[model samples]
Target: MTTLTVGSHRIDLSIPAVMTIVNVTPDSFYAGSRTASTETIAARVREAAAAGTSMLDVGGYSSRPGAEDVSPGEETRRLAAALEVIRREVPELPVSLDTFRAEVAERIIRDYGPCLINDITAGEADPSMFGTAARLGVPYIAMHMRGMPDNMQQLTDYRDITAEVCSYFEEKMQRLQEAGVQQVILDPGFGFAKTVEQNYELLARMHRLTGLGCPLLAGISRKSMIYKVLDTDPADALTGTTALHWECLRQGAAILRVHDTREAVQVVRLWRKFRENS
Candidate 1:
């Protein structure tokens, strides 16, 4: 089991935990997850907390493949609004800021105090990200992606997806630890830089990544790996997502970053029961 320290809150990871997604961007790959207004963000936070989510992940920038890039200023403003609502309405719940920009992360930490930083770039996009995370002393989530979102799909030329991803984490984890980051979580970036086949391949061998000795976060949620294979849309991929969530847990994932909190929470609960009995 792994533990994550976000501010004064210490998250015990003996059992799998759910990190619910609250996207403030309009162009997120999943249409159902886009929440722009403060009222909607507050409502979503309240709902996710009630549904038993262990953490709330708020993102202003859209990281979907080929997604339009938003400036740091805009991203900061959007995140500030969302965080303000979360601070006011659901201050008790731990929050994770989903951004790869160091400036945006620094601003959020200064204003919001200590929280988790879920950087998709793994500190590659912004050279200052690791230092900023270390300075703030927050849990950093390093996701494995080969390239920028606009061109990541074309860069999926890994000789061995799992091994390459594991190697990537091994290198990045060393840098993060050296920079004084105490807690680092691994996210395999399921749809960011991999082909549909590669995504499943990595998931099948996900347990191999556990040797890195960090908590694994599986963010398959309503991603294309589920919908594309099922010949369905993201809107209808909940069943498939739930199925894969079980596989991820069985493979040693400590966290599930998901758009649908209730279903994921149910998955974690049932998976825990199954693991206990077996």
Candidate 2:
């Protein structure tokens, strides 16, 4: 069975893990995820813990398309505050720090302890990220995004979305392995650099990526890929997100990065029951 050793905790991926999003940024694509103050951050963490979230993915820097760049110092400050609250409230829950900067990852780990490094750039944005993750000895989640967030929307021109993404992960896993990084999770970046049509195509063929032998993380929670098709908004995308979550489970997704922990946990439970009977 595939597993991730996060700090002292070994996360079994046989049952899909729900990694709840705890965004500290001012402008994440999903408004419901943004926690601007200490009270809100603590409340969000508590709520997720109560809802049975497998892990908390706290991100300070916003990666939404066209998001303004945040300085590493500011990002670290925001994350430190959020991390402090999480440690105080739910110290035992596994945490994943969503960042691409080696400096940010190093400082956060040094001050707060170990956390899985979830880099949307996958070491492409920061050359030292792989080495940092390796040295810190934390599980790494590498997402496949073509360019920086501000310009990623313009870089979506893949001939075969699924095959190319699979190749990208295969090469990335090899590189991470060579860099001495252990336990890498692959995220195909559902809406990062892909168009709406490309996103659907990638989801349809996501099962192929499981052959890479790394756990897959699906982050399609309340994304435009769902709302755009249904002509709705993120707040109303929960039902659509649940439908996609079921499909992701069917396709062997090991983790679901989500904003709604309760709904995701329920989906995972139902999926587990279905799998047992199947």
Candidate 3:
């Protein structure tokens, strides 16, 4: 069984786990996910915890394609507010800070002490990220993305998406290990740089990524791959999201990062039962 250690928290990966999204930015693709204030974030955290989420991922900077870039100071200020609420309301719940900036990662670890770092750029955006994560000794989530959010869509020219992603991980994992960063998690980055068809292809071959020797996290909750394929909006994409989530579990995803906590938890439970019975 694989496990992710963040600070003193050891997350068992023998069964699938749910990581709830708590966006502190107003411009996130999903409007419902954006919490405008600390009070709202605190309430959302409580709701997600009650809904059975094993972890909470808080992001101040929106990684949605074409998102306006915020200054690091602003991003840090936003994240600090959300972190304060998390520490005050649910100190025991394991938290993951979603940002690719090494400055933000370093500051958060210095102030908050060992929360997981979810870097969408996989250390390519900021050169110091791997070293920072290594020094902090926290679990690191490295997502596969070709470029920054502002223009990543233009950078998706891969011969074989799965093979390329696997190679990317193989290379990045070696560098991270060399940097003394342990407890790594791999995220395929559903819609970052891939087209809708490519996203589906990657999901179809997601099992291939398990060979990287890290827990796989599938963040396909109400993403464009679901809404666009279904000819619907994100608010109406829950059914499609749930359907694909089952496929993700079947393909060996250990963690599901989602906006709908209750449904994701239920999916994990049902997937575990199916695996046990099979």
Candidate 4:
């Protein structure tokens, strides 16, 4: 049973958990998750908590393909404002700060105490991210992405997607350990740099990653891989998301990072029942 230490909390990975996404940016891929104001952010957090989310993942910068660059100061401001609202409204839930900048992660932790650092770039974008996570004693979530959002899509040329991703995590986990990061989580990066076919290929073989010895986070919530395949939009991909959520659980994913909380929690519960009976 793998466990992740998020702040003062220990999340048991033996049973899957849902981490709802709260995007403070105006231009995140999912319109339903875009919460720009304090009122909207708080409402979203409350809704997720009420729906039984195990963790809240708040993001200031949008990592969608070809997304415009957000300045570090603006990202920090957006995240700080959302964190303030989350802390005030839903203080009980553990929060994960989604970012790729080392300075942003450091500043957020320094001001708001500890949080799970979810770096989409896996410390590739910023060299100091691993050290910052270690220094702050926060659990680090490393996602496998080829490059920054603007160029990531063009760099998806893996020889063997599953093996390559597993190898990447092996190297990254070692680096993180050497940097003194005790707790680590791995994200397969559903839509970050992978194509639709590649995403499915990786998902079908995702269980192989569990051998790397860390909790795996699958963030395929209403992403283009689902909506694009179904000839639908993000708003209509909840069914696809739930279907894929079950697949992720079956494939040994420990956490589901999603936009819809209630359905995802239900999927986890059902998956657990199915597993027990199997």
The models' CA-based lDDT, in order, is 0.92, 0.93, 0.91, 0.91
TM-score of 2: 0.98
For model 2 the local lDDT of residue 138 reads 92
TM for every model, in the order presented, reads 0.98, 0.98, 0.98, 0.98
Residue-pair clashes, model 4: 0
Summarize candidate 3's per-residue lDDT along 172-203 as a digit string, tens digits: 99999999998899999999899999999999
lDDT tens digits, residue span 138-193, model 1: 89999999879888888989899999999999999899989998888999999989
Worst 10 residues of 3 by lDDT: 1-10
Q: Tens digits of per-residue lDDT for model 4 on 1-278?
A: 47777677777778899999999998998888899987898889999999999999989999887677899999999999998998899888889999989999889888987899999989998999999999999999999989788888899998999999999999999999999999899999998789999999999999999998888999999999999999999999999999999999989999999999999999999988988899
Clashes of each: 0, 0, 0, 0
Per-residue alpha-carbon lDDT of model 2 for 1-278, expressed as tens digits? 37788788778887799999999999998898999999999999999999999999999999987788999999999999999999999997999999999999999999999999999999999989998999999999999999888889999998999999988888888989999998889999999999999999999999999888888999999999999999999999999999999999888899999999999999999998988899
Query: What ranges in model 2 sit over 4 Å off?
Result: none
lDDT of 4: 0.91
Colliding residue pairs in candidate 3: none
Q: Whole-model lDDT for model 2 versus the true structure?
A: 0.93
User: Cα lDDT for residue 267, model 1?
Assistant: 90
